[model samples]
Target: MPGFPRRLTSRAAAGLALLPALTILLVAHLGSTSWTIWISLTSSRMLPNSNFVGLRQYETLLNNDRWLVSAQNLAVFGTLMVVGSLLVGLLLAIAIDQRLRVENTLRSIFLYPFSMSFVVTGLAWQWMLNPTHGIQKLVRGWGFETFQFDWIVRQETVIYTLVFAGIWHAAGLVMAIMLAGLRGIDEEIWKASRVDGIPAWRTYVSIVIPMLGASFATAGILLSASVVRLYDLAVAMTNGGPGLASEVPAKFVMDHLFERGNLGLAAAAATSMLVTVVSIAAPLLYARSRARTAETRR
Candidate 1:
């Protein structure tokens, strides 16, 4: 018999290597998602039942006040968290990159929060923001009788507290991304800009930002995914308290799944979220594909 061709042997080895990953992906991720979609169409109770209910679950979910509020909260939280984390993180990265003293120490200090479980950090934030025990009480003890930082207890502003802690936890990741991008910049660009008498701010705004597009894209995508799946921090900190002002979509789905025992509704909410994500992402993806095609043609 003729020996196997080298290319055929290489292909067979590659296929073998991919088999485990493909199996896991098919069983765990794709299989679960398909199950979710199917269950959404069924009248599943506490556990998944086989009774088909058509689009009734979707209709019920659409009519749910709590689900609607959760979606709204998610929108607000996602917007604020993404924008705030990116801006602050970029600034922090730039400052640290300036050859400052104790750069590693400062970097570690900022990144430490990311390593912590939200259970610990969120409780700490809750304590710090508590009206009777936290910043307000400390300030009152300092002789200022009217210093009020009680937004944490208010229905209107409690979501902002989530944004604050979310930013604290997330900014480090963004900073790391930006720092990597900044380090990859050609040193000669800085030298040339300096010799041209361009201000540091101008150079960063016009030159550095444009070149760091890949880094920003990476950070933005990561942050957006986190925003969509926000639950742990909210649970640990506010528990969707102050009249559901801090509720988010992930929490809504989880609540319906486990707490409310409405798997059908839960699946409906999850499906809605998936639709929203696709709606937003589709245009961006199309634009990217077009850009890549144009670049190739050029």
Candidate 2:
């Protein structure tokens, strides 16, 4: 007993060690969120003020055409990016899981893009997608003079281009997630499928994918967060250009908060984003918790 460490003492010491970090997080992040929410309810513009004008900013934000466009753009981008990334990532993971001779090399190449900053990814994709000196020109030079790959410059298609770049950047991360899930799968599943005359694709589609719920959830959460704060990619690639065609909510908030000196509107937009994320996430988290509780009872 003399040589043993007391559990209460250890726990107390750990809590004490974490106290500073916990305090900082509460003050910095929580305080900032509360402040933003409060600001959104007020008439603050160009600077903070105590003048309370509740919901005015929200009403204005709802009416703003640019804001509506940004929301629509985000909706399109989020849907396409998430679906495309998941599909491409799953395919890549399945391919790499085949235990090819160059599996590691291929995985490294696939995951390399995720390691790069969004700015770098955006710029690289931008240069490659540029109409004048990029793919279109290169293809035209090769004899197909009418080949049109100028999506980046078209207002209707620029957002799709962003989605493409986003998928290219995020698919590797999703692949890494899916690959881990694939590897954790029991080998017997494969043997059983082979014996039962089930194709590998069918096994993956029905059984393997269903079993990888946690992996999919984890990847979805990460990708969803990226989708919410999509700023740098849009900035570096299109700068919300071709007449606000590729504008996203984050960029709208940034432009209002910084460039346009509309702090109240920006805060409202930020608060709306926060509320939307919470609205979606809270239910999922609650359901997950309920499921775990039921499992425990069983």
The model with the greatest lDDT is 2
lDDT agreement with native, every candidate? 0.91, 0.95
Per-residue accuracy of model 1 over 34-121 as CA lDDT, tens digit each: 8999999999989999899899999998898888888888888899999999999999999998988998899989888889887787
| Clashing pairs counted in every model | 0, 0
Off-target runs (Cα >4 Å) in candidate 2 are 1-12
Please report how far candidate 2 places residue 26 from its true position, in Å.
0.9
Q: Tens-digit lDDT track for model 2 on 157-219?
A: 999999999999999999999999999999998999899999988999998999999989999
- Provide the lDDT at 91 for model 2: 94
Best candidate according to TM-score: 2
The global Cα lDDT (0 to 1) of model 1 is 0.91
User: In angstroms, how far off is 242's CA in candidate 1?
Assistant: 1.4
